[model samples]
Target: MDIDRYLGPGHRTAALVTSHGLAVADAAVRLAEAERIHEEKEELAGTLTRRWGTPCHLGLQTVRLRTGTEEIPEPWAGLSLRVGDVYLWQVAEQGRWVALGVADLDPDDEIQLLLVVTDTDPP
Candidate 1:
């Protein structure tokens, strides 16, 4: 998904779509002013959010998507993909938005496994 051109520039300039779909879906509870409904929504959102995925799974590809840096794996050798802090973004396609969860290098400095979430935006 991070490599999907459908997200950046030609599309909506939003490459990494963060998965806040669950919370977004439960937003109604916030407006409804129902404590029970709100709690349920929160629980549901948390579960779905974790189940979806994280943006960090993109790894080096994320660097390219975020900073236009492709992974080369060359330490101090010209560059090898601009390395930096990880980031998350909300992506949209056909009015459907997704959330790219947090990212970080695993203990091995590799792409950390994560869950990404998706949700439809209200018109």
Candidate 2:
């Protein structure tokens, strides 16, 4: 899965795909704990349509937060993300490779959080 575009300039995005099935709410809680503003209304795009392909589900979510007037931290300081901006995260998994993307974000933007896996990994 390619996630380069969603990551803002000069910022880095990281994700972890696990074999365990994590509830959507449970993952959202983790994101909130990381200080990401979780918005559940947004529609996340991307899926495997092939008949014989593994079945994977995609979760789209956005988060907004204030960094205060103080200078933004390194890596995130120069990025375009702001207090009201919404950053996109993609959680995709078919079998065991569930991918998670995190970064500074803007509102209402579309991003691809790709997850590719085999039949062994269930959504």
- Could you report the Cα RMSD, in angstroms, for every candidate shown? 15.1, 14.9
lDDT of 1 by residue, 21-99 (tens): 3343445532343334334434544664575433221234443453444432212111113222322334434333333
- Which tens-of-lDDT digit does each residue in 1-123 have in candidate 2? 343433543334332222122233364644453342122212222232232234232322221122354544432332224222222222244222322233324323322232222222211
Q: Once model 1 is optimally superposed onto the true structure by TM-score, how far is the C-alpha of residue 50 displaced, in angstroms?
A: 0.9
Q: What's the residue-level lDDT of 122 in candidate 1? A: 12
Alpha carbon deviation, residue 114, candidate 1 (Å) = 25
* lDDT for model 1: 0.31
- Among these predictions, the greatest lDDT belongs to 1
